[model samples]
Target: MSKNSKDTLKISGIDTSVLRIALGTWAIGGWQWGGPDDGNAIKTIHKAIDNGINLIDTAPIYGFGHSEEIVGQALKGKREKIVIATKAALNWTDDKEKIFRDARPERIRKEIEDSLRRLKTDYIDLYQIHWPDDKTSIEETAMELEKLRQEGKIKAVGVSNFSVEQMKSIQHFTQLSAIQPPYNLFEREIENDVLPYAKEHSLAVLCYGPLCRGLLSGKMIKDRVFQGDDLRKTDPKFSTSVFDNYLAATEELTQFAKDTHNKTLLALAVRWVLDQYQGNIPLWGARKPEQIEGIRDALGWSLSANDLKTIDEILAKHIKNPISPEFMAPPNR
Candidate 1:
């Protein structure tokens, strides 16, 4: 199990230390905002850690390096206490060898160095390939990761947004310690491949988008008119009629919470993912204090058998798989 702090939840496994609940910082860097404001960004990150969250996730591509800088700023003095997980893939260019793309080993080395400088850390706790480059042999990219780990630059190696076959192929480089993918009540595609593979291999499965990109937060409604710049506008689930369908389904779950007076829709959504296994750690992203505040009620509880069956029934009736072609990261071409 885990050492339960008043604010943080810690879960340990055979391989490494796992913080059951962690702060995923993409939200503060304006994942939804055109760009996140520095003051607010600092506050939210500090608040998450202050509230006992010890792990943080970010990627170089998030806001074109802005997110990392913000994370570095937020964790200035508290660096040693926090476990940071960041990724490299889909750089400014695809030349991994050319200082841009996935081809050059030199580029990969430079990118890690640059990330270290930006992060203000001598070593990263978990370093992940943000996505796989299909152009190069998976082994070729993994070799660079192994090199980084050998240099004491990173504690563990992992991959984000990888398929089962891709993860297995990369594992040939060495034992991969973790795998990051999207998993939520609304999106369960990973259940069929990624989750089982992680379980069989003893790899950490970090579930990003645990809030379903804010849909499961119980904020967006069916008929709401979204402005042009919002990411949700492009999300199919937010489409006029489609959004209503999603809301209707969530409404049922919300009602269930009321019936027991025990859970919020956000808590139920988070608990549903956690219920899948002991290794599942949902990486929660928060934009403001309120966003983090909304999900706090979800912690410290588990769903009952009837609750689990009811959730499945609601999803089966109203939700379809939302994994679209756009959601799939394009192969490094």
Candidate 2:
């Protein structure tokens, strides 16, 4: 890849809005923290921003705001240059603006204030609702978000973990500028509706878990038991029987990555998500500085149409079982 091509890709038809490769901070401040090796985590955060990663995605529940604090510390001087996207908790009542347990309007406002304080910034670039809450209607939550945007507290409004129907429901009330969904080689559920809806509406789709939570990283052994409170242990794909099969598939895919015009497995993984044309940007969570370097290495290059086709064929051949049965279904329903 050439340096000239860096930042050449756009996120949502916005010329300056290139792939906002986001760094998920949950690992830094949550399950992976205090594991005797935080130097790489902190170093990777700083390095990712320096490499033109404009977006950093985090949430209050990620170590209960510790992730935001870490991001703030990492972005101390360059805060204005990067976009910090965080989420409001998911427990607000539909009729009430205040969150009694998780996301009352008052609590949302308070949480935003606290997040801003911790981030050492005046306003957030994108403030997203973490997840849907049956207690509250998305309309009310979206209205509150719009209010905050108008007040200049948040520049954009986004949502995370919203299904196609849920996204359409919220769209009825407000312009949903963005959506963060877990999408990867193994997970193809969003392709049915979320991707098309986002494209039709000009919404930027920030994809989290782009590497299938490290399953597609071309790393990990069958006997690998997760240490500490890592979420991967609970993931169905990570089980010994399932993981071995996943690994074999990843190995075949990794070779395609190597042979198909020369990109690492990591690069190919990132490219697969970015290549999805629904204004997609892959949210890359790096625990080590080298991981950030791996992402950066993917920059300034793109997969050709033939390469993409080959990749599709390879995925179809190898990922036989798919992540889940629902993954094959259309999201429109």
Candidate 3:
């Protein structure tokens, strides 16, 4: 599909011309995924934009402000062409290694300012609470974001990793434009409630980890080893027996893509996400320019009912030990 073929979604009355895919900067942040080269990260951002992707999802906690900085540098003169969707509320201690949720009104105020400085933008297109903070009342967090919206600091208010009840509670105070949730073939906990609720409430749903942090990229092998601060080293899906099961499933899925669609597993994985729900945007993470090349393939085709059934059968056949991305969650405090 052409760039124009990508659909648009409206959030909080703002007309956003977004592709089916968005560029996620979590990996570029280089905190959890692995150490990322600064030059490569900036190039990846440019490549995504050049390839027709308009929305870029980032967070302050990513690399403790490194990812946003790289995004700012990449968009120095090209900011007008892209939609910036960033998150706040998750803060780090002095050491920066221990991070926790803090959506207090005062914390939100400070976070927006810091994010603005790092992103090199006066007004953010979408500002989301990185995670729900149990320490602060949801009402307080919503009111703070509403205030920021009124002040023109953020165009839309959103929340990430929030439950249905938490969403309802916040909606009582202010309008929620979107919700960011981890939704991939392996991690689908949000489909039951978060996704349906967002659709019912007219909130845009942006699903992150579209490739399950590179597991569905069709590159992981049993012998692959992760080093440094790479999260895959500790990810449950990457464990011994579990990794074998997932790898087996991925290999079958990869073969299916080659035989059925004449595409790569990366394209098939993202297309499956787009076909599963209406108005769902899959946030694709990439740390290198070459990684964005598959965006076009993911757009033009979709999965059929039979294909979906076959995919389920493949998962059931090989993945005896399935795992969710629960370890990535931040502390409630």
Candidate 4:
């Protein structure tokens, strides 16, 4: 990935150019992480583009479609330059209590229109199924996406949080251009399966949680008190029993980054993710411009082969029991 945003990932079917890191709008929607301010969120989006990031990813369930609305409001008059990717198949109740998978053909027909209306664009650069719906077969889901592509509603088809088998199933019916998965320093399960499949199949890997939900940002402390609707308060890794272990690992990583490369933990983490594979694209999340200023520092620098080994050693020494990001998954209908 060149350790820089200068390199772009081109989906086989999409016409737009996407940077190495995409601007994630999950926090901007603000349902789980308190609430979002339109002014700040808009500025953040502009800053990300101003700083070389041209890809933006959002979902309808993010703040119940508020994130897509905010992203739509931010890209007025300049939508063509940015690669806008959004998801469907995940729906919530009117009261916003229960979120379940709904990848039925009828549901996708309505969801795509709603997303188009909210994104303020005629066609989405990349349209991804948020998650696989067990109730619906991959043939039905993939065929529906192909139909959308035929209609020009979306340029490329993608699936997030899908296993290798599921992706293979999807390919039998349609072209799969990308796969979005949660991957970070604290989480490496995808490295064993999903990444290899993407690499072998020529699919773009849009890696989410590159900063481990801000743990690799080096700003969270051991005694930090999470306020508001922040989802970290409920993350299993942030609980009392294991928080210290992860924090300790993060602290050591912070020191190693500074001592070895004179870089902040945020920059080092992004570089690490980019260096892991030749085409890995990390999705950087932010709610304010200031939070993303460090992304530039991550560019033009590659971590050494020895540096990766050191990181694994550090994690093995400090973290006794590691955990995956399974808790963040939505319910399957």
lDDT per residue for candidate 1 within 291-315, as digits (tens), equals 6674456666677888888878987
On residues 184-289, what C-alpha lDDT tens digit does candidate 4 reach at each position? 9989999898999988988888889999988999898877888887888889898758888888998999999999999999998898988887668899999988
**Each model's lDDT:** 0.73, 0.72, 0.86, 0.89
| Model 2 vs. true fold: TM | 0.86
lDDT of 3 at 285: 93
Minimum summed lDDT over a 10-residue window in model 3 is located at 1-10
Report how far off residue 58 is in candidate 2 (Å).
0.9
On residues 85-163, what C-alpha lDDT tens digit does candidate 3 reach at each position?
9998887889886888888899888889998999999989988888889999998899998899999988888889999
lDDT of 4 at 116: 93
lDDT of 2 by residue, 1-333 (tens): 235443344433122454546787777766444342456667988888767677888876666667777788888788777777888854333553333334456668888888998888998887887767656666777778878888889887788877888888877866678888878877888888878888888788888888877777767666777877577655677754666777877888888888765777878888778777637778888777777777666666677888878877877776677765232221210
Clashes of 3: 0
Which number leads on lDDT? 4
What is the Cα-based lDDT of residue 212 in candidate 3?
A: 93
Using Cα atoms with residue i matched to residue i, what is each candidate's TM-score against the true structure?
0.89, 0.86, 0.97, 0.97
Model 2 segments more than 4 A misplaced: 1-18, 32-39, 91-103, 325-333
Worst 10 residues of 2 by lDDT: 324-333
